[model samples]
Target chain A: MLRDALLIAGKDLRLELRSRVALNQVLPFALLVLVLFAFALDPDRGLLARATPGLYWVAVLFSALLALQRSLSVESADGNRDALRLSGLDPAGIFLGKVLAVATQLAVLEVLLGVGVAVLYTTRITGWVLLAVTCVVATASIAAAGTLFGVVAAGLRVRETLLPLLLLPVLAPVLIGATRAFEAALAGSPSEGWPWVGLMGVFASLYIVAGVFGFGPLLEES
Target chain B: MTTEAHRQDIDSTGSNGTRVLGIAALIAMAALALFGLVLSPADANQGEVVRILYVHVPSATVAYIGCFLTTIGSAVYLWRRSRWWELVAYASAEIATVFTSIVLVTGMIWGRPTWGVYWVWDARLTSTAMLLLLLLGYLAVRRLPADHEVRTRRAAIVGLLLVPNVIIVRQSVQWWRTLHQKPTLLANGVGAKIEGLMLFSLFVGFIAIGLVFAWLLIHRFRLAWLEDQLDEAGLDVAIAERRAEGAAS
Candidate 1:
């Protein structure tokens, strides 16, 4: 199962590497959003401190949404989803592969956005280790949930609109916790902020298990 | 009776039953509305805003009923693979969304006058909004494509997964320090701070609104099922026409 999952993950990453659409589309959008935030605030350092966490997550979330929609949508639009299901691979493997790809794409976006925010806003990245840990925890949760929901929503014909609406609501808790944890870590608040990180870990596991269990039947339905 | 024949018989018998229910619900609603609005005395402390409880409590109860029905309907459909349960679940979810919306609005209206604000990030309000969103998501999933077998199956999964949301919504007050008031009547097999005619009026209002919700659910379910049937019929006609054209050629 692990080997099969890696193969599927490799296939997705290779396709993305060939097309370059996910990185090309998502990076520009993330960078533009970051620059827009910078200009909108007009180089205020204090405002940046307050807005940095929110701005960063918003960039990550919207960019992840863009990447996620593109990732699952290709199989759906080309009618290759059925073929994937019949390829003698486990559906859970497909879900795991897609989620890993989403997580990787989001991780790259986060690093870039973090650097942009630190440069443009004159903000310090205190507690680098904690910041990195929080990012991974939050990113894992968001990507897992997003991939799970993206697959579910992709089964429908009107997925482009419905996916975000359905995905956002279910993901609200993760967003709430992740944003808080990220903010706390960046501010160097304290170890007290770890609860929200714990919450993200729980959410990530729940979504991963749900995706593993549900994705097979869901693909058949599609 | 066999499954197909049984379903046909049920479908035929359901309309007359629904009409009788409609009339009965209408009368109950009218009577309760008058009693709760006109006949019930004002509370000594809360004044006219206390009257908002008439609508608010009933709407909350009906929303609960709607959510409960969705849970049951979703489960039955998933277990039995029967379309009837799916129709019922979809119908109940639609009605629940409207009532939950009303509950939020009425609560806000009552809040503005009593709490001196139109909105707060209170636990009750937030959780109720979450419940409303979940319901919308469920309905949207069902609506995006009208495939019964596939749609119903996915909807059932979503519905099952969403059960925890209902619990959280109900417990938001106990779990968090919410600005909104707690349940005034029957939190735990008993009423608090309300009794006599007010309590009776509230109970009657619950029953009346519940009946009205049932009436709406039945009507909406039949309409949705009919729409599916019509779509199927249209497909049949299109297929037959194509076969005829081929044969003529």
Candidate 2:
């Protein structure tokens, strides 16, 4: 399963490697959002610095939405879905592959956005250990949940609008968990971030398991 | 009667019998409103405005029940591939959404009189708002245009999501308690805090709302089942038309 997942993930990565849609469009969108957020909050004030964690996650979420849409759109075109089904690869492997590819893309995006917050919002990154752990867990949660809903929404005409509505409310807990953890790390209380990390871990596991079980049926539904 | 006949009879019997329950609910609401407004003494602390709890508590309870039903129906639908389960989930989610909306509106209206603010990021209220959003998502997925099977399968997945969300929303309230009161009703039940007439009024509110929910669920289930039959009939007609066209050619 892991080997099949890796093969699928490699294909997705190679596709993005060739296209760079995520790198050129989504990452810059994330950065631009950081700048816009700073402007909205008055860059000179310390308010932007304090709210950086929340704004940072919001940016990641929006860009993650874009990347998810793009990833599924790629599959929807040119009989790629039928091709996948015909290949006889495990559906759970495909799901895990999708999650891995999206998670990898998001991990890169989160790193760049983290730098953007540091640079634009002038908020220094302390508590690197806890901060990295929070980002890892949070990104996995978002990627797993996004891929599940993305495929669920991918086949419908209303998907463009429906994906965000369906995905966002469900991801609310992830947002809260990640933001709170980031806030703790930023406030120099890295010890306080553990419970929120646990929350994210649980949230991530729930979706990953759901994606594995539900994706095969969902993939066949359309 | 055969077992299948017996089951069908019970369903109809249950649904038809609830008509009386609906009228009973109507009477209960009137009495609830009256007793809550006049007979029940005002709180020494919260004043006459405390009357809203008679409505608000029941709204929250019914909404939670709706969520519970949706998740159960969703699970069964996925497992059994049953349209009955899908109909139940769809109807229950819509009812849950309405009840949750009432909870939000009533909570806000009641908050203004008591807390001096129309809204606060309190734990219970915040979680209730999240519940409403989750239900709205479920309803949106259901309303999306797709094949009956496609939509049902997708909506079932979305429906199953509410269980995890309910837990998270509640945990969030406890993890960061702000303005909202903690779980008060669970400790020794309603008999502990609310006495006599006030408790009686609250009980009436529950029966009224519970009966209304039952009434809505019955109608909605029937409507959804009819929709499925209509959809299949339409497909049959279209297929026949194609066949006739091919024969004419």
Candidate 3:
């Protein structure tokens, strides 16, 4: 299963690297979101700084949506879905591989966004460890949930709109937990942030297990 | 079966059992309105605003029941591929969404008079709102045009996910609320004392709402079954027409 996962993950990442869609489109779109938040909230009054954690995660969430759509669209075209089903690979491995690819993309986005928040919002992060842990756990949670729903929405004509409708509500806990954790880390309160990390961990594991089991049937359906 | 007889069979999604259940629900609902509106005394603190609790609390309970039923139906459908369980899941989810909406609106109405606002980030309200959105997602998936089997499988996955989603939402919202230390309006809203008549009225509300839920579920399931039959009949007609055209050519 692990070998199959790596193979699929490598294939997706290679496709992404060759395509450069993430670098050219999703990254700029995420940064644009940061800039848009600055415009929406006046930066001079320190409101933007206070809301940096939430704004950053919201941007990540939106970008994750695009990334998930892209990930699903990769197989959605050219009968790749059918080919993959007949590829003699385990369905659970495919699920984890897709999750890994998305999480890797999200992690890179997070690093860039972290820099963007630091520069654009002039936010100082005191708890680096807490900040890093939150990103890893929260990104895993988002990617696992997003990948599961991505396939669910993949074969539908209204998939573009339906994916978000089906996914965002389920990810509400992630947004809440990640934002709170980021707020704590940025505010130099590591103790307060740890619990939120725990919540994110729980969410990540729950969805990962769910995706592993649920993906087989969903893959066949899509 | 003859097409005419099949048409007649699918004409009405009703039976004697459902008629009896429907009549019982109507009677129970009428009694609930009478006891809840007239017999129940005003709360010492909340006064008239407290009356909404008759519908609000019962609706919330029924909504949870709907959620539970959907989970069971989804699980059984996935395990056994039973169309009956799928229809049960679909019907219960729609009803749950309706009841959850009622819970939200009534909670807001009660909140306005009691808490000076129509909304609050109280844990219950926030989680209930989240659940409504989640159910909407499930319904949205069900509405997508697809092969019937594909659609059912997709919806079942969403349905099964609801349990964990609800638990996570509730827990995270509770933590979100407590972390901020906002004054909990919900705690004060329902903390008022309930004596004999009000208690009895609330009990009547439960019976009324539960019966209404059962009645809706039966009717909705039958309607879905009829829809499936119609789709099959339509497919048969199309296939027959195509065959006739091929023969003529």
Give the winner by lDDT: 3
Q: Interface RMSD value for candidate 3, one decimal?
A: 1.2
TM-score top scorer: 3
Q: Rank the candidates by DockQ, best first.
A: 3, 2, 1
Candidate number that wins on lDDT, 1 or 3? 3
Q: Candidate 2 - CAPRI tier?
A: medium
Best-to-worst lDDT order: 3, 2, 1
Quick one: best DockQ, which candidate?
Answer: 3
Q: Which pairs in model 2 have colliding backbones? A: none
* Candidate 3 TM-score over all chains jointly: 0.97
Clashing pairs in 3: none
In angstroms, the error of model 2 at A66 is 0.8
Interface RMSD of each: 3.1, 1.3, 1.2
Error of 2 at B202 (Å): 0.5
Per-prediction share of native contacts kept: 0.40, 0.49, 0.79
Computed on C-alphas against the true complex, the DockQ of each candidate is: 0.38, 0.65, 0.79
User: Which residue pairs in candidate 1 collide?
Assistant: none
TM-score against native, each model: 0.85, 0.92, 0.97
Ten residues in sequence with the least summed lDDT for candidate 1 chain A = A190-199
lDDT, candidate 2, B1-249, per-residue tens:
595884564364246466777788788888887888989888766777778878888988989999999999999988999788889999989988898998888878878877789887666777888888888888888888887778888889989878787788667555655313555422332234677888887888888788788887887787777677668877999999999999999
The alpha-carbon RMSD values of the candidates against the true structure, listed in the order shown, are 4.4, 4.0, 1.4
Task: Please list the residue runs of candidate 1 whose C-alpha ends up more than 4 Å from where it truly belongs after superposition.
Answer: A41-45, A127-130, A155-157, B1-16, B165-192, B237-249
